[model samples]
Target: MFLPTTVEEVERLGWKELDVILVTGDAYVDHPSFGVALIGHYLLSKGYRVGVIAQPDWHSGEDITRLGRPRLFFGISGGNVDSMVANYTASMKKRKTDDYSPGGIGGKRPDRAVIVYSNLVRRFFPKVPIVLGGLEASLRRFAQYDWWSDTLRKSILLDAKADLLVYGMAEKAVLQIAQTLEKTKDITSCHGIPGTVFWTSQRPENGIELPSFEEISQDKSKYAKATALLQFWTDPYRNVLIYQKQDNRYVVQNPPQLPLEQEELDRLYLLDFERRTHPYYARMGTVPALEMIQFSITAVRGCYGMCSFCALTHHQTTHVLSRSIDSIIEEAKMLTKHPDFRGTISDVGGPTANMYNSKCQRRETQGQCKKFCLHPAVCENAKVTHEDYLELLEKVKSVEGVKHLFVSSGIRHDLILMDKDADRIIKKLVDFTPGQLKLAPEHAHPKVLKLMRKPPAELFLEFKRRFESLSKTLSKKRYVIGYFIVAHPGESMHENDYLKKFIQRNLGYHPQQIQIFTPSPGTLSTAMYYTGIDPITGEEVFVERSLKHRNKMKQNVNTNG
Candidate 1:
């Protein structure tokens, strides 16, 4: 059943007042893929009366107050994607459309949506506890580089005046908050919970203090150092507590919540999600995001790719969490019963489809590995395999109503190349992929790929050759579509030229998918973009700050210059 979004829906559910109200910047889709839905559903599963206020009007208190006041706390999210990224492009222009919106229109959400919604709720219900989560809050939990403003901003918790900020996949932390508030009746008592950040005047003992916001904002080198330190201490098992002084108060971040056990992860996806946007939103128009994923299933939760330009590690962490096969097949069987089921599962994977069941026992015993897991070389301790994933897919396909199951999520090419059973994996992926296998090689130049923490270009080429050969052997016509990034932190015109030549000499065609680097918050690449220094190696990098030059470099590569 869908979580109540309106007071009428709440009343129909026989609830006098909601225990928690979730505010988001996206149209409500009660699917597990959406964070707000997943969290709202989880709270309901625990017997809390939860409601959602999606894409409320920030200009007035009317829309924000429609659900009335919650008995417990208000949860705010900047939707699935960050507000700044949703509202603006890489070149910092206002985006004309938002996929998560009712009609796929832009301007439905405001800039800094999390902060805006939190302040809006505070204006109406001044004393209600406000909890912030989702991509925007998670990535900005620490003071980091803000690309749109070109300034280092303080943590979103301080800017939003939120009582608590839940980072990463926040199902566990948020439930703990609800439980704590139900018993103690004081929101502040919920501080120091795993996966939560709160501000305190007293310095936290034994906490690793990052460079203060004042220090990092002024000194780029210090900012890089802080970024490195925060990432280094991200493991939940490590039990590292980190804090950074904003001004007078210090923001203390407890160690992340441990990866949910298989049973715990399995239960979250089995919730009775309608798998469609709420009727209220459906009447407005088709939500583009929902349309794409309503038929898809999230087979996994977290990723361990740890790419420099990606924020998956900071938000989802480097842990690769997969649900049990029986649980996934159960969800697949349920999907077939839905009225909208068309016998095809659009996707059955997470951040990286092939990373399912990929485990690193060494990292679990000893904290996060100091070495790169998949960048320069796949670490020996990192066991990259596809046996379990292949079995999971085969079982899902064997479901009575399931006809076609596609692995649409980006496949880590490095993993496939490193796997011992490469032939079987490639053949299965070719059969599963509709036609084009999505691979993100990022760039061809060695220095730029190194700065981006991507594998050597030669590895990608070898994988492509094997994949295309397998497609031919299996009598399927399939091709590898490469995703490239131009003008990243270390890429100059010379490096971009190398990328252009590589495309011409290797692929023989200008690949359609290419993007200019945006340098968003909470990414190692963004730090290098802002500081012109790689934090890990402490070496200088060339950054293209000029918009014209950045655009020209992309144009040159696209035009096959």
Candidate 2:
């Protein structure tokens, strides 16, 4: 059973033999599809006692420690820490906020709460094994460039003092870790688990070492490609040899599984919820903002959009699999039944909102398409249709108690505007949409859009006009939130100047939430950012996002008044 995060409450629950205690910073609300709720529920079904600590202000070390140290394992993730950092840095410049200052917990510093929690755990129970997981740890799995600090840094595990780092989908590895820990308390005994990186006293002095390049690489070309790719991988430290015990070597492995069938996706969502009605509600107080209605739901995992700058496609393996409509409805029903139910659903979409039910057309023939579609030109044989996604939206909207269903995820404007069914979806959105639609055109410049592998700006403008026309006809107020990227490699000052004018003329000088391009690990843009050259071709390039350039852009906006 899962208990809320309170010592007395946990004791009263009498789940001391609980096989695992999953500690997370994300909320217990399953809507947004953060990993904690799913993993915690999965553990409970396996008969493990579980508890959730949602967004505990890590500043109070006591708050984290007070959860009653259990004979269990901890799971942690900060939603999307890398993106959060990038967003924070960009926001700070515009707001003139000192949040990222040395004294502030902002900037590229490890999440303060996560840092404090780790220190507190070590201080209180030094021997208890601590494993770090989530985007924060995973993307920084190797030494990569840190845009803020402008230097390469080692893996977050080494910096955070975590005993192990679990990268990629942690379902299997987390289960194995819990079962193994329940049987024994030794860290060294866990060296054999797949999808985990660990360090032990008995291991080689440098820790569990990965296999050398020669052993893992089949050819010199592959090694050269990896080495070249590594140069542009940005973090805060230099790359070091980190071994994966599963494959018995240091090389990166293919991501685990990409569930394609609806049943598999449903099983992933049908995880057990063991928390009783009372304690679960009571623990809500411990969370800073625990509104049940503010939960998010991921309709799809993995994005085929394959934006050059996005790490999601690479990390998630770019196979767009969606939760079944019935599964989505079921989860929505559960969210509405919560005592504090609000009429609105916070977010209902994944990497891209409109791409629900999207899949490869060649799935039946190719078994599964492993390679990402990374062309500037849209695929002529695009398999997923707009009709399929509209059906999903209709089903989701029909769920009882769902007053407002919103799409907080990015929209693939290319697909939405190109397809005839997409026109219906947009019209439906204007008529039936709860209120807002967030779309990411990424850039307005043709050359930059080409590099980002995004739809043409003209297409987005046309879609915007059509959406506006629909909104006017329906007598509904609707607006599109545009997303743009700045400081991409090869983006010139002249280009940004033109972009600013374009936003002023088109998006109306409202500061269109521009993001400074930070090269995360394992993206084409990252490769370009690091080497000052494109990885696919040996051509030289200029990487943008210098501190001066960021300041200049901000100044331009401020002065534009």
Candidate 3:
């Protein structure tokens, strides 16, 4: 069931007021895939009255005050995506569509939604505790580059003046917070808690101080140094408090919360989610984001692929936690009962589709595992297997009413090569993907791939050779389509030019769509873009800053292969 979005609905619940309220930038979708719905369901299961205020008008206080003040706290998020990314394309052109908004319209939410919503709430309910969660807050927990503004900005916590910031999967941390606030009524005294950050007057004696905000702004190396510390300190077992300064106080981030174990992961997916948008949005029109993911089942919560351009590191763990095969089957069975399910499952996957049922075993050592899991080479200790996934798919394919099951999320090429039964897995995967398999090569140059911490470009060529041979032998009509990032850090203009020619000569066609590099906050790539240096080696790298030049690079991919 959808959470109460109006005061009358709250009254219909036979309650005086809600215990928690979630304000988001997206339209209300009460599906487990949507963050607000997942959070609300978790709180409800814990016996707290939860309500949601979604896509409220920031101009006036009417929508903000409609739900009234919650008794405990108000949770804020910029929906599933950062607002700036949703509002604009990488080419700095305005976008006209938003998957999360009603009627697929843009401009439903402000550009910097987290700050705007927090300040709007403060206007009427100055004393209520305001908590920030979701992608925008998690990635911006520390001050980093902001692409939209083209400058380094302070942490989102400082700008929004929130009471607390929860990073990564917030289920475990949020429950602890609810209990603490209920008992102590002290947000400040609630320290040493995992998966959270709060403002402190003085730095803790045990904390690791990042290069002060001023020093990072003055020197590029300092930013890289701070990022190195940030990435290393995210390990929950071997972590120390990390802090950076604002004007007068410091933002203290506690050690990351321990990842949920298998059984725990099972319970989260087993929760009662309506798995669709609230009926109110039906009047406005269907939500594009919900419709796309409604038939999809997420089997994992984290990734080990530490791509510098991706923010999964900040929002999740290197270790993957997948739902049991039985649990996944249960969800598939549930979908079969839904009226809208048309016998085709859009996807059965997560972050990196094949990083399932494995561990790096780096925990055996008592320090952070600093090496990239797939770059250079796959770690020897890393357990790579496809038995679980392959067997699970076979069983899911046999389920009644399942006409076709497609693994839309791309299985990493490197992982496919690592599996023991590569030929069988590759043949079946090729058979399953409807037309083309999405491969994120990012770039075809060795230096660029190193900066990305991805496998060498040669790996893609090898994988393509095997894939085509298998497709021919299996008599399947399948092809490989590449996802390339244009103007990435460490890439000279000549290299990007080479990429276009390389695809044409080898792949025999030009890519129709090209993803332009945008320096989003909290990504190491963004750090590299701002500092003009590699984060790991602290060596200067070439960055294309000219908008005209970058657009030309995008056009090169479009106009030619």
Specify the highest-TM-score model's number.
1
lDDT of 1 at 401: 97
Query: RMSDs, each prediction?
Result: 1.0, 6.5, 1.5
For model 2, the superposed segments whose C-alpha errors exceed 4 Å read: 25-32, 53-69, 78-88, 91-120, 182-194, 198-255, 258-261, 267-296, 361-374, 475-477, 518-523, 557-561
What lDDT tens digits, residue by residue, belong to model 3 across residues 1-561? 679999999999898999899999999998888888888888888889999999999999999999998988899999898988989988888899999998999989999899999999988899988889999999999888788887778999999988999988898888887888899887765566899989878877877889878888888789888888898877787767899886678988999888887887777777887777787675788899887788888888788788999988879767677889998888889889887889988888888778777666675334348787777888777676787887778788888988888888857888888877888888878867878888988888788888998888778888888888899888887888888998889877788877878787778877865788888778889889988888788888999888888888878866642
Order candidates by lDDT, high to low: 1, 3, 2
**lDDT for 109 (candidate 2):** 29
TM-score of every prediction relative to native:
0.99, 0.78, 0.97
- The lowest-lDDT stretch of 10 consecutive residues in candidate 1 is 362-371
Displacement of the residue 327 alpha carbon in candidate 1, Å? 0.5
lDDT of candidate 2 over 1-561, digit per residue (tens):
344566666679775544455554444544224466667676666777777665555545665666666676666665434434523455334222222121222322234334445666677667777777777666666544555565544556555676776766666777778888778876556666666665433334352233243432333233224534432221112223334322222323222333336775676665544322234433433322333224556678766676778777545545566787788888778767766667677667777777677655564234333333535555665556667667776777778887777666677776776675666778877744556676777777776776676777888788888887888887888977787777777778777776777778887646547667756655667656766655555566666656788667645643474
Candidate 1 segments exceeding 4 Å error: none
lDDT of 1: 0.90
